[model samples]
Target: MRKYIITGLLVWLPLAITIWVLLWVLGIIDGVFVWLLSAVQAVLPDSARASIRELHNIPGLGVLVLVAALMLTGMFVANMFGQWWFRQWDRLLFKIPIVKSIYSSVKQVSDTLFSSSGNAFREAVLVPYPHPQSWTIAFVTGKPAGEVGDQLATLSGAASEEHVSLYVPTTPNPTSGFFLMMPRSQLRPLAMSVDEALKYIISMGVVAPASDALSAHPAKQPAAAESARN
Candidate 1:
């Protein structure tokens, strides 16, 4: 009886959680649609409002509306005039003192994450952290830029050597992490893709990428050769 019950739960638990999550998200989106409908109905004649009362209860309407709005925005932003307007809008945002700082930082991060040509998170790496011989998986964001790179070079007395920026995400919650800048020679590049590494991290190493995959991608190369190739 115990085995049967455990097996049944194993089969059903994931399905139940997934359904619950989907329903919860749908309910929240539907609430937005309901609020918007109520606002519009406030100014409408009673008879007209009554005629459209059924629309207020429609599930997933807000999701549809949100998708449509995003599509329209994308279409609008694809043109020359739209690009000019966007630049002007960005300028206006930059004029605000506090808002500009927050907005600019977020925009830069989003651009790097979403840009097609961006190199952020392109490779997975391993580096010693907290102590020697203890290593953690990290994502290579890019090379350190501007003053940070210069300062690191000066401190290390290796102005000619390149330093790469990495994010070492914590297990189970990959969103929060430490940002590190280390010389390229120290990082051990891994064969795993960003998605595969993420899965390993999020699963707390229980789910690992295949070792065979690493065979095709060498983890280490001579620093001199790497610098020369780059």
Candidate 2:
């Protein structure tokens, strides 16, 4: 019973934290979203005002704004001038002792998880979740591409297997979760189809996949690992 409670905590706590962090980031973006709406109303020509008003009245505007911001940021960085300015800005942050630690760490991680390339979210895997003592399911999103791949290699002593980008989905709702990247060697590969993994995860281990693949391997009982000792 004690172990069950502990495991349950391990599962739900990370999900809660991931959700809280997501909401926090969205909250910040939402503020910007609102500000942009007001700016659009104030600055646009009379002919554009009605469309701006319509946009302001609609739902999910914040999500749209957030998407637009990311798209614009990506577009900016892709150009040569934008790339030059980005490097300068990046270097300036790196020069700051405390800021560099946070900035670079976030940059490397974001690059690995979010960089657009390769086949993202193609496979399901099992790994220690929240901590190594417990386990959960994740999807193989993609690998680090281009310069991000180089950065990952430099982190290790020598050239090594590329880190696999992953999306660790939450229980009950498989959509929202954490993004991760770890060495391919460290992963405990699972044979379960990605769809099967999603069903198992969404059910919180209640609806197991109708396959003996997981059961046949006693040692690699990843689905069972999320059972919280039942």
Candidate 3:
């Protein structure tokens, strides 16, 4: 009985937490839809209520309807008319003082992260951080570009430096992390897969293994040294 209990916990613990988190998010979104539907019902006329009221008939279905509506709206904005309208809308948004700063910052990050051509989160790399010889797992967020690249060249003393932005995520919570920029030569590419590296970090060093090949490998000696200068 004791052996079986340990096995059961090992099997079900991850699944239970995963399901619990997902359901919690879904419940919150569902509540938002219910509130919106209620508001619509109050302002809507008797005849017009038929359309929105149909949404309330299906249990936990209003959120699905809202999601579909949002997708369709996005598709419409992706068209030609949407392009012109979006620019006008953005111009208006920038006129607002406090809102403009927050909106613009978020927009820039979203564009960089979601752009098809961007190189964010492409690889797992090892970097010396906090101290020399101390290593940490980091994701290559992107290569510095534009004015940022120009500035890095002066700071790093390389006219054409390879500066990469990395996200050094903390343990257990990968969503929040430290952002850093370092020369590419300083970053050592890790042989481990990203998923394995993430698991190692989330476990807070309790679940990592020594890399024999990586630790043992050394630079090859020059072949000319063997032949001698004679």
Off by over 4 Å in 3: 47-54, 191-196, 205-230
Name the lDDT value of residue 50 in candidate 1.
Answer: 86
Candidate 2, position 192, lDDT: 74
Q: Write the per-residue lDDT of candidate 1 for residues 31-56, one digit (tens) a residue.
A: 88888888998999988998668887
lDDT of 3 by residue, 115-226 (tens): 8887777678888996777999999988777998788888846777678999999888888889898988898876565676788889898878456423332232224533
Count of residue pairs whose backbone atoms collide, per candidate: 0, 2, 0
Q: Put down candidate 2 lDDT per residue, 109-214, tens digits, no spaces.
A: 5775566653555567887778879988888877777897888888955376668888898879876899887887768888677778888998799888777766
Stretches off by above 4 angstroms in model 1 are 43-48, 215-230
TM accuracy, model 1: 0.84
Best-to-worst ranking by lDDT? 1, 3, 2
**Which candidate comes out best when scored by TM-score?**
1
- Number of the top-ranking candidate, with lDDT as the measure: 1
lDDT agreement with native, every candidate: 0.87, 0.80, 0.80
Q: Judge candidate 2 at residue 17 and give its lDDT.
A: 90
